[model samples]
Target: MKITGYRCLTTQHDWGRPVGDVNGHVDSGITEVPILVLETDAGIEGVATGSTHDVDRLFPAIEGEDPRAVASLYDRMIARVFKSGHAGATFGGIGTIDAALWDIKAKLAGEPLWRLLGARDRYVDGYASGLDIALDDERLAALYGSMAERGYTSGKLKGGRDVADDVRRLRIVEEALHRNAEHPGLMLDANESWHRKQAVRHVSAIERELDLVWIEEPLRRWDAAGHAALSRAVRASVATGENLTGLEQYRPLMDAGAVDVVQIGAVWGVTHFLRVAVAAHARDLPVSLVGHTADAAVVHAAAAVPNTMPTEVQDLGSPIGVTIDQAFQDGGIVLGDEPGAGIRIDESEIAARMAGDGWRSAAGPHVRSHRTGLRLATERTA
Candidate 1:
């Protein structure tokens, strides 16, 4: 089927999820953000959203291309654009297109995306992220407990502000998850909140006490050497690369022995993530998906890849207006036979949430006092 057109809809909200808190960096002030739908002359449609990829610039390149040839089309688009002037240009743009194209292709084939990707495993483990430092102890308990109730036995909390606070929250999370599993898988994200010495000292202190599944972005994303040093210093596995743009960008961290689990996410879509996933498989390392706003959604990429560890489902318990046709049970999320990512969103509810009272970024850790909201858009994902 030939591509016909596309649409972009976005709105702002008053909720935010941080990488870490109090000390961690990378604060974002986004909310609900935007969702894209690529329409085809054949009546197939694809949905996507993530990162600030220049989607506007991409439409012309793939306007008439075969959506079924997603990989080739993606590669062609990359070759056509010799250089990405901005940081997320390559990943944000390419990945979203790839996702939308995959949606169209999967619809044309009358199969779910996982079926095309391989369907080797029908389920991937999920973990609750976003125990933000900004939240009080009561909110923290509610969020984590809410997550566990949704059948998630594993969870990760934002750490790296204060040793005492981290320790205290870890216990709180442990209490929550233990309600289900005798031994729950726990993780942490410091979001480069600490200096090298501070990170080492902090992780070391936690290592002496807690059993963490992994520590995410423990240092600045660019700190390959520091990540390596911290990886060696900590007992927990290190997962990085969410901030890094592409495979070439991630290779250095892999080579430096900095990341135990390579994370591939929104910026690069399924095609790029598959490249990294295949490479990680060859290296015998685990690959994880970083969290995203649509309930930490892992759109069309999970089922067929190798060396994939438990992926993220950040807002599983939050009343985010987006959802998918999947079941969360047995500590894993199961995909439905729906074409594409199977995402369902309520634009009106999201607009209400965004227009409510405060303004906050959905992806990163930033909040502002903005009073106005984006003009709402009509819902379109089928």
Candidate 2:
């Protein structure tokens, strides 16, 4: 079957609280870059892309490609636009298409993406990603207490600004976990806010306090050497790569042996991220899907990867995940035997919420924002 058409949807929400991290806090409501729908000729359509900015520009390249030729289409799109610096958006745009194509292919073949990706297991373990930076130790303890009840034996805390304050927060979470007799594993994400010296020092101090599963993006994204050095200095594993664009950029970090865990995102779409996972597996490294605040797609991708370590379930923002038709059980997610990515979009709901807003360009064909969101649609579309 061949591609038919595509649409982009962007939605905005007023956040109830500030989503804080080392980068500062977002007090306003959050915006969602949800992927809409892609139509195909085989009488099958699916939502493979989740909340992205430029779903419109991705249509042309994929409008006529065969659904089964996902890898070829992916390579062509990457090679065609490789020199234009459109890697991020191109990857994002094509990712939706590739996912849809995979959905169609899998449906035709009567299999799930994971089975098609050759995984023997459908259930993968996950960790709760707590987002209660504004809460005091008592409240934070209560929050973590809830996580333990949910069956998550692992979790990650957002850190960066105040080292002492973060240390206290970690203590609270640890105490709560132990109080419940859960012995849940703990991890921290600095979001590239700390310097090498600060990260090394802070990680060392907290290492003995909490059994840190890993430390994510403790320093800037480009500091491969620093990360390598820091990895060598600390007992806790270093994890990164949520922001790195493509395989070329990822190669250096992997080659340097800088990170013990690689974080891939579905925002780059499912296909590209899978390729990265394969590369990581080749190096005998573990990977975790970065929490982009979207659900199912990344969770499914992580499940499909043979070397996946832990999937992330964020605590902040929307009630969408909790309201999904499927259930997240036993500290893991199972993509219940649905064809394609197995996510059904509530089109009427999405359109009404995103009414009066569609694809609009402030710059050139390769430069546009699908709506008010900051997602850069940088691909030249015919």
lDDT by candidate, in order shown:
0.69, 0.66
Best of the candidates, lDDT: 1
TM-scores of all models?
A: 0.85, 0.84
Provide C-alpha RMSD values for all models, in order: 7.9, 7.8
Instruction: Identify the candidate with maximal TM-score.
Output: 1
lDDT of 1 by residue, 1-382 (tens): 6888887766443344433354422344234456777888878778766643577776777888878888888877676666743245555767777777877777777777888777766677777776366666777787778778878788888766566777788878888888888988888887655657777777788878888888887777888898899888888998888867666777778888888989877546778788888878887899888764452234447667767787777664333466666776766677787776776667677666554312233323443213211113211111
lDDT of 2 by residue, 1-382 (tens): 7778766655543334434554444434243455656677877775654544445554556677776887887776665565665466556666666666676777777777667776677776777775555555666677777767766667778775555666677777776666444676778887776778878877887875666878988877878999999999998899999878787888999999998899886567677778899999999998888763544555667777778887777653333322232345566565567655566656566556642222231221123223311212211111
Runs off by more than 4 Å, candidate 1? 11-30, 292-299, 317-323, 344-382
